[model samples]
Target chain A: MLKKTALHDAHAALGAKLVDFAGWEMPVQYRSALDEHHAVRTACGMFDVSHMQAVDFSGARTADFLRHLLANDVAKLSAPGGARYTCLLNPEGGVIDDLIVTRRDGDAFRSVVNAGTADKDIAWFQTHAAAYGVTVKQRTDLGILAVQGPQARTLVVPHLPAALRERAFALKPFTAAWEGEWYVSRTGYTGEDGFELVLPHADIVALWNALLADGAMPCGLGARDSLRLEAGMNLYGNDMDETVSPLECGLGWTVAWVPEDRAFIGRAALEKQRASPPRRMVAVMLDGRGVLRAHMPVRDAAQRDVGQLSSGGFAPTLKQSIGFARVDAQASAPFEVEIRGRWLPLKQVKAPFVRNGKALV
Target chain B: MSNVPADLKYVKSHEWVRKLADGTLVIGVTDHAQDALGDVVFVETPAAGRKLAAEESCAVVESVKAASDIYAPVAGTVLEANAALADKPELLNDAPYGEGWLWKMRADDIAAVDRLLDAAGYEAVLAAG
Candidate 1:
């Protein structure tokens, strides 16, 4: 049976099309994906992301444990409420998952991971924590809601606790603060100024209703995927997997190579890869009349097969198709994508084709 | 929902065919199909004057999420193709029965139309699943 989230009824009430996604029956779209995508880019939109698992680590050695487990340095989260984006990798430096880790206190931190990989991530942590005496707890009682867009802050501020409102408004990017029972973080996947709120699951329905009454549009996974793609964010399994390394997945910037004395799980293998990186992830904009889709073959100027599109879709904001392709590092700026046996011309551009309702390409 | 004129015929796969004043028949996907496809992004139609057999794959419609093949409802020779869809494919989602018609064909055997489902039978097929 497919698992359902706390907001499943709410999605159905709004006439959303629900589909099975990674073991959860979730809303794929409400009304139209293009409209929802435009709404989040132009104004505000909310997503019920309760399916994502939240794991908490608490112990004197929590920081130490994470330092050795993550490819990025978790010690940099020295200040309370600071958050860092990092990747957990295998011994060979292949990506296990990319997640956000926030320091709630000196000995406690919260990490939210993808729903499909939650069990494996928790098991990995448990297996590694035994040596460090750290405790890993999955908080299934909490519900997460991401309210994102240019006007997201304004829509959510009035509903927050008065004391927490000011701090949440002032919170820096990638930081979270505890307000009573709510954990509000100024972080999002839409490349917009927004807050991810973690609160009691029982209170989610009331909160969702309040947000809808305040004119915040309810969006679903379809808009979420398109919005994140436009923001150039990577989906866990699609953009990279166990066989792919972070360096080749447009995530080398997130790796921390400092503190040469401290070796993490994947450092040596990564260092060896750094000497000779094999492939590079590039963003391609389809210039012709075709939609870029996953597994579509990419061709070089000579029409030789170089790589394949890992993720692709039509950007409602840009009115064009865009995608990420893993191609040989030697493949230069111009390329083409094979769609329906015809090579559609494309231009390799910097990521984030659109953000904040504006085309950045 | 709009009515699927009784005079026209449909396939369980959702293609619709209407006999024009001339002996040719017009072909397109149904509104139900376009709604399921969300926003139509690109379309690939067969060239004009090509001959197609009944149930033969004749065109392709691509949305943001998936691609679908449009099968020929009956054996016919392609008479004309919708040139407007080449630049504006969303017409398939906006007007699947009118401006979004994919192609027109001259039926090789007019009796082939009798084998197609009528409006009521097509609706029953849609209601089943």
Candidate 2:
């Protein structure tokens, strides 16, 4: 049986089309996916990301444990409620998962891992945590709701406690603001202004309903995927997995190598690959006819196979097909991708296809 | 519950066929197919005057979720393909049977429509799935 979120019935009540997503029965869309995608770009949209699992760590050595586990240093989380995106990699320098780790308080931290990789991530966390005397606890009682777009904060501010309302706006990107049980983070997967609220299970449904009444369209995984792709955000399995490292996944920036002495997992392998990387991930756009999907081959001039697309889809905001592909580090622009027997020219670039509802590349 | 028109013939692939008096048949995806496909972003129809064999892949439907191939039901000569879908692919999801018709073709054998399942039979195929 597929697992259902706390808002499963609420989604059905709102006419959401539910589908099995990463073993959880999640809403793919409510009324229309394209409309919801536009809502997030132009206005506001909400997503029930309850399927994502939040893991909490608390102990004297919690920070030390995290510093050892993640590729990104947690020392940068200088203040409470600060979050940073990082990758959990195996010793082989392969990305097990990417997550947002938040510092709740001194020696108390929380990380929200992807829904599909939550279990594996928890197991990995628990295994590495004991050595540092950290106690890892899965926050099953909490659920996540992502409200994104230009008007997302306005729609969410009224719902927050009066004391937090002002602070929420002041909350910088990649940071968080919390009061007792209410947790709101100014972080989101979509490259747009937003807040990801971490609420208890009992409070999620009520807030979701209130947000809907507040004119925040309830988007689904479909719109979520499209929006993130337009923003050039990477999907876990689609972009990186155990077989690939951060070096060629358009996430090399997420890896912190400044503290050379810090022996984080996969650091050794990454150091060796740093001097001469085998491949580089590039964001690509298709101006020709046809959609770009994951695993599509990317070829360079002379029709030599270079690499395959990691993640791809139709960008509703841009009204074109966009994707990220891991190609030869030596490869340059002017790539070709064959779709249904016809070779279509692809434009490659370094910047994200879109950011903050604006086309960048 | 998907709308299965009783007058139109259906194929197991979820395509609906409307037979005309001139032995020319109009082809379009059914409501069930469109619903399953989510929002249609693009549709690639076969060129007009192309000869197609039974069960041959002739067109493609790209949606937000995934891309799918549309197949010809029986041996036929393509009369005309839907040009509007190139500009407005949402028609596949909005009106799968009307203006969303994918193509019109003359079947090699007019009696081939008899080999196709009727509405009830198509619903049974969907139910079995």
What TM-score would candidate 2 get against the native?
Answer: 0.96
For model 1, the local distance difference test gives 0.88
Per model, state how many residue pairs clash.
0, 0
lDDT of 1 at A297: 92
Model 1 over residues A84-147: C-alpha lDDT tens digits?
A: 9999999998888889999987699899999888989999999999899999999998989999
Cα error, residue B82 of model 2, in Å, equals: 1.5
| Per-prediction DockQ | 0.67, 0.84
CA RMSD, predictions in order: 2.0, 1.5
Error of 2 at A331 (Å): 3.2
Candidate 2 Cα deviation (angstroms), residue B129 = 1.6
* TM-score of each candidate's B chain against the true B chain: 0.95, 0.98
> Which ten residues in a row are the worst by lDDT in model 2 chain A?
A348-357
What candidate 1 gets wrong by more than 4 Å, as runs, is B1-7, B47-50, B83-88
